[model samples]
Target: MKSNRMVLVFFILILTLWGCEEEKANKEVKTHGAYTENNVAQKMDKEDKNNEKTAKNQDDNNSVQYFIEEEDFQKFAKKGLNPFGQEKKQINLSSTDFEYYIHGMTHQKVKAKEKWDFFEMHPKRIKWLLEGLEKTKYKLGPDKQKYREILKRWKQKDFSTIVEDHNFIWDENEGTVGKATDRLSQEDEREYLESEYEMMHHFK
Candidate 1:
């Protein structure tokens, strides 16, 4: 009888220990699941904040106001004088627009082998354009750095290397140096300029 009672006691003790272990395992599983859920929530919150920040930055960039408008460029181009001519009306252009205008003007001048007399005659206008560029809201990078240097040189009344500058831009645009302006005949160049001017004014 005592032996049976001892066996019964041993069985009861075993069941109690097994129950405690199962409860401990269940608690550990719940804790792990809670930790995983918290991690997911935290990760989602971080991603949402990052997306909001990126969207805000895009909005800010899109909302930037430029000093020059397309209409202003059209009016300026219609006069058929050198873009920097002394007789032309003064128009302020943002840095970005100034860069575009300079490229078009320089390309035309180089193709036509025109004199740089406009630079000499339009000192005040050039100074005003440079000032407008200087106050632009956009950040200047390496490419724009070249424009800045050109503007500074022009401000100092030095346009001796404008042909070299034109070639540099030409090469930068992936054009062959040997065929920079040589490949285009006078008639071809004029046609190309007319098409380019129409496309620039109308498409934008």
Candidate 2:
């Protein structure tokens, strides 16, 4: 009877060991599968993020919408492009606008190839151009008759139907208007960036 009892105990011990081995093997297989799946998911997520960023940058590079409203341009011209008015009789311009304008237009008069090249490499550089337009200081009597002539040219140059090369240049008008354009300036862009930057800091 004692010998039979010992045999029964041994059988139970063998069964327990087998059960443990099976459990361990199952755990290892499940763990490895889960790890592979996670790796693949992470790679796909990163790829998607990169694609989104690229799309956003492309949009920003071409953000400018061309052509000021013809009526608005005329209104600005009628205002004599001068902030100080005719009574003040003195022209004051910020250094930022004056320096940038000549350099920006220098492409037209001196280096057409270089100007075109600049736009090809970095289109966003022209984002600051509208601002420069707002920065121009109006001198009295640029050419009243000439201003009229340029206005005619601007009206004639509208390319509502055409595509490509729809450039809007300063009308060669001698209006005593305080400014050539009512465009947003670099200062304005800077201010907006700063405001947005400050607003975003808290999220980080």
Candidate 1 wrongly placed segments (more than 4 Å): 68-204
lDDT of 2 by residue, 75-127 (tens): 64587642211212113433333332323322211212212211111122232
TM-score of 1: 0.35
Steric collisions counted per model = 0, 14
lDDT of 1: 0.55
TM-score of 2: 0.30
Instruction: Report the error of model 1 at residue 52, Å.
Output: 1.3
Task: For model 2, give the RMSD to the true fold.
Answer: 20.1
lDDT at 101 for candidate 1? 49
* Best candidate according to lDDT: 1
lDDT by candidate, in order shown: 0.55, 0.39
Model 2: runs farther than 4 Å from truth?
57-204
Error (Å) of candidate 2 at residue 144 is 54
For each candidate, give its TM-score against the true structure: 0.35, 0.30
